[model samples]
Target: RANRDHAAGCVTPVISQNSLISSIAQNVLSINPFQQMINEIIKQKIAPLETRMQQLEEMVQDLQERNDCLNYKTNDLAQYQRRCAFHIYGIAENKEGNKNAIIKYIGKVMGVKVEDSDIYASHRLKQNKQGDDC
Candidate 1:
């Protein structure tokens, strides 16, 4: 009789476990459709934002390329201007001398007739204590 009672007790626990598993499975099945609907709604809301992000990334890339091109052109223009520039050394530093005086001196000493209109601008640079032009 004791052995029979022990066997019945074990069977009771097995039945309770089986019912618990069945209940959990039913709850999951009921929630599956609701979860799927929520996921779909989230995806729908994010789709436009994802597309706009892609477009913004493309715009940023295009702007960077344009900036690089402009920088290259600016450097090229600087080099071209430097090529046309001329520096006259060994000339006396006259604090009172202006652009016209320099042009006249060039015409008299170098015998090169430089027109006033031909010269855009001229100025004496200051020398540092180390004798370097600043």
Candidate 2:
């Protein structure tokens, strides 16, 4: 009778341990589907934002290219304007409209022959407080 009781006691503990293991496995199985569903939901929510971010990056790149092109065009235009114009400073302001004399003076100083027709326009700038034309 004692041996029978001892065998029953051992079998009860084994059955309890198996029940605990089975319960834990069922919990893990249920949680796996729930976790998978959560992951799918997160991915769905992030997809549109990711696409919009990529589009914005492309737009910024296009704008930068356009800005660079505009800067190059501006520099070219400035150079073209400069080619047709020249500024001379430190010449005494003559009120007699001495455009020809100025041209001769410049030609003599630069060792270059300059005729009156070579200058398209000549005008004195406004004198500053120090009596210098700017």
Q: Which numbered prediction scores highest in TM-score against the true structure? A: 2
Give the per-residue lDDT digits (tens) of candidate 2, residues 22-132: 999999999999999999999999999999999999999999999999999999999987796777777777677687778778888999988888777776666588966
Per-residue alpha-carbon lDDT of candidate 1 for residues 52-122, written as tens digits (9 for 90 to 100): 99999999999999999999999999998787567666678776768677766777788887777877667
lDDT score, candidate 2: 0.87
**Per-prediction TM-score to the true structure, in the order listed:** 0.67, 0.69
- TM-score quality measure for candidate 1: 0.67
| C-alpha lDDT score of every prediction, in listed order | 0.85, 0.87
